[model samples]
Target: MISDKEKPEGTPKILPLCYKVAEHENIIWVCDGAANVGQIGHQIGVLLTNMDKARMCCTTAVAAGSKPHLDIAARSKKNIVIDGCGNRCASKVLENAAVKIGYSIDISKYLQKVPTLDIYQADVKRIAEIVVKEAHL
Candidate 1:
């Protein structure tokens, strides 16, 4: 179990249980790749989740064929996919599993892709705002 002491100061001590409440949640799946856009996409997911606008789930688990995660995606009210670039890796994972995606966006459209993990909070907020408006979150 995760302890509050282990989490960052401003982070939530406990988050909404995504699996148990997926049917009423807008689930976010982001590509956490080794690039600026990818990192920004990930932060955007986290931002939306922390703001209670959506819940970010494990795209890696879905890619690895986790049945529980796949079921959660299947039952979610909306699946919001955020991809780093034109690759659309996160979206493809859900599509391959036959999971319906209610909303999807490629971060490259808003930011230039760079081969670095470093990202800015400003970019995250900017992209997150776009997602909230576009995805109707």
Candidate 2:
């Protein structure tokens, strides 16, 4: 099992980068629960200046109907789906809405190469960076 130690300190306390960027531009962060605890959320949160401007959604198969998820899918431009594993729950959520994914990141593929990296803070950061870089964020 992945150790909780691998996660960044105050993981649940951090935010997502997308949110941070959104805030800087007076936009919002539309995130899915697939990034529940890690650098992905932190990177995204750094972009959030206000809670009302940032939105969090459940990408899980069951929580797909949540308002946050629906709101995100309905309005997001160039949707980005960050999946914690190969299940690709977030991607499916957007696809179901007939929303095309402009970019995607699968953490499971990274973990396979860097087995020692914790899925928490550092791993999340690395993945988020890659996603942002790839997406030109």
Candidate 3:
């Protein structure tokens, strides 16, 4: 099952996500998710970042006590937390880390039925769109 030519395995790498506060469009996006949201929050954040609307940061790194990640978030001009549902785990993480959220959106509001942590691709896009619209970002 193993081969010498195969790449070695270890902890997954976390690239440095820090950036100048003003260089970004004044929005720091934290892609956080709960068990009931299965990285959907993260996906939306990525979309927003790809659109050049905001800068995406790691939720896992910050939650796991990465100072660099937390520092970047705390110092952002506007820290935006996108939660996948009503649980608000992402918002809590930012709050506990002493980062204030200038704007936030819960994806559950966009759905008529309660969903598991896993989300649909269409829903992800819709959520990100609404965030951009509602937040005036």
Candidate 4:
């Protein structure tokens, strides 16, 4: 069994998508900000890729001026933008580019009335399911 600290040696860690990207490779997907505000978006990104149901384009890729990544995103037939907080960095990227996002999920909305910055596994899964439903995938 793989411990939390160990990944199969040859396994390619998920690329942060900062460089080149395959042409129109993934269909249904997300472009996460992957920021450290609360890690909610990062957790959602891991779940998004791990489930094998969708793809993720990192905000870093767009920020770094990767045309292929931007092209892929702009042409994507479907996309779910998940923002970690009201700052809306990830969503703003799509909007700025005029990329039509099919859906948007903001992690801050899931916060309790008191509003804490912490999020748990269950919260991530719940948000993922919500995205899956919204995207109809």
Candidate 5:
């Protein structure tokens, strides 16, 4: 183990392991796409996770037919899907895998979809709060 001096000043934040905590945690799967709305969706997931409201899992792992991830999605207390646009790629991935979606939102509906990945913290906070209310997290 490292010495105390090697550690950071603040307490380390240890989020629940998605796979291990699936039965008790709300699992978030976001479409980390290439646009502003997509980027915001990703940030929303991070915000919720950091707030201990949910655990963000890898959407790609489920899409790639990873048994562990698929099981996590199915076993989660709530599977919250966040898609950046109308395409709903993230939702479709879970649907295709037969995982039930507890709640889902299309970020494009709330924010204009832009080409750039840069997003505003205000937007992220707004959307994340909406998610907390809607998903009952």
Candidate 6:
């Protein structure tokens, strides 16, 4: 039997692209807009500290049928998807097109009990720390 802490043999601990992008120090990070309302956005920033730029997709454009373009965008470079909830709209959009997801961070499931933090500069920094720690980045 496998231990809880053990990952399947050959499975990468971090996203493959994350490792690849980290090598260049210029990868793009993408976040779902659902997470833009509060500390989640800030947390994303923290998680993105290792990247060249981080952008938020605040609309359903990709989910609304622009999946090809989104896939194209994701393919243009290493991509990490951060979804605020488990609905995983962002991951789904990319996965459906057979695109590989470098990393996926779900905030709703991470801080299940913490009260919503107001979307502020400080809050963003705080949340970003949580995300970075969780991702071990």
Top candidate when judged by lDDT against the true structure: 5
Q: What is the lDDT of candidate 6?
A: 0.49
- What does the lDDT come to for candidate 2? 0.47
Weakest 10 consecutive residues, lDDT, candidate 1?
Answer: 1-10
Error of 4 at 124 (Å): 0.9
- Candidate 1 residue 9 Cα shift, in angstroms, is 2.2
Q: What is the lDDT of residue 94 in candidate 3?
A: 81
What's model 4's TM-score? 0.69
Each candidate: RMSD to true structure? 4.9, 8.3, 8.5, 5.1, 6.0, 11.7
TM-score of each: 0.91, 0.51, 0.71, 0.69, 0.91, 0.49
The C-alpha stretches of model 6 lying farther than 4 A from their native spots are 1-39, 42-51, 55-59, 113-117, 120-123, 130-137
lDDT of 1 by residue, 7-99 (tens): 567875478788899999999999898899999999888778877788999999999999999999999999999999999999999999999
TM-score of 1: 0.91
Lowest lDDT sum, 10 consecutive residues, model 2, at 22-31
Residues 18-95 of candidate 6 have per-residue lDDT tens digits of 333443332333443434432464355444542424333322455565754554445444445666666666667667
Ordered from best to worst TM-score, the candidate numbers read 1, 5, 3, 4, 2, 6
lDDT tens digits, residue span 1-137, model 4: 11123568899667534224333333333344334334766776666665655566666666566777678777665666777777777777777776777777776687542244455766667776776677675
Error of 2 at 63 (Å): 4.8
Query: How many pairs collide in each candidate, listed in order?
Result: 0, 19, 2, 0, 0, 3
lDDT of 5: 0.90
Give the Cα error of residue 83 in candidate 1, in Å. Answer: 0.1
**Cα distance off (Å), candidate 6, residue 72:** 3.2
Which lDDT value does model 1 have at 39? 93
**Worst 10 contiguous positions by lDDT, candidate 3:** 1-10
